[model samples]
Target: MNFRAEIDIMPLKELLDPQGKAVSSGLKKMNFTSVEDVRIGKHISIKLSANTKEEATTQVENACKKLLANPIMEGYKFELIAE
Candidate 1:
């Protein structure tokens, strides 16, 4: 079986996002005042072969924990779709 994983990695809420803040400031300068705040994150898509959805889930979670996201500063979530 083949599976596709969609992952999101974001800075922890306790941490400051300078990139997001910069974008927010830029938006306000451009007269988009309704936007109060912004936070930037990464979206990742992965396709892999696995025997079952549970195996795919484990693979995706391991990827996130070991390489894709920083546990101390970032958090991640993912969804798996059968392909």
Candidate 2:
């Protein structure tokens, strides 16, 4: 079996995001004022061999915890689908 994973990792809401804030401010200056509370994150797409969706999810979660995200200041979520 094969699985595909889509992952999103972002900073915790309480944590300060200087880059996101900066981008938001910039957007306002550019007349895109409706944009607010903007936060930036990474999206990861992965393809792998797995016996089940659950296994794929577990593997992706472990990978996220180990290297994809900073658990202390960030949160991550993923979806696994059959490929």
Candidate 3:
């Protein structure tokens, strides 16, 4: 079986996102005052071989925990699609 995973990595809400803040500030300077509290995150996609959706989800979660996301200040979520 084959699976596709769509992953999102983001900083914890309790943490400060300098990049997001900077972008927000830039937007405000450009008269986009309606935009505020912007947050920036990473999106990733992967396709791999697996025996089942559960196995694919486990693999993606492991990858996020071990390499993709920083568990100390960042969190991750993923969607597993059988292909």
Misplaced by over 4 Å in model 2 are: none
Q: Candidate 1 or 2, higher TM-score?
A: 1
- Go through the candidates in order and give the C-alpha RMSD of each one to the true structure: 0.6, 1.0, 0.9
TM-score for candidate 2, residues paired by index: 0.92
lDDT of 2 by residue, 10-80 (tens): 99999999999999999999999789679998899989998877788789989999998999999999888
Of the candidates shown, which would achieve the greatest lDDT relative to the real structure?
A: 1
Return the candidate ranking by lDDT, descending. Answer: 1, 3, 2
How do all models score by TM-score?
0.96, 0.92, 0.94
In terms of lDDT, model 1 sits at: 0.96
Judged by whole-model lDDT over C-alpha atoms, candidate 3 comes out at 0.92
* Model 1 Cα lDDT, one tens digit per residue, 4-53: 99999999999999999999999999999999989999999999999999
lDDT of each: 0.96, 0.89, 0.92
Q: How many backbone clashes does candidate 3 have?
A: 0
Query: Candidate 2's C-alpha lDDT?
Result: 0.89
- lDDT (Cα, 0-100) at 44 in candidate 2: 91
**Regions of model 1 farther than 4 Å from truth:** none
How far does residue 39 in candidate 3 sit from its true spot (Å)? Answer: 0.7
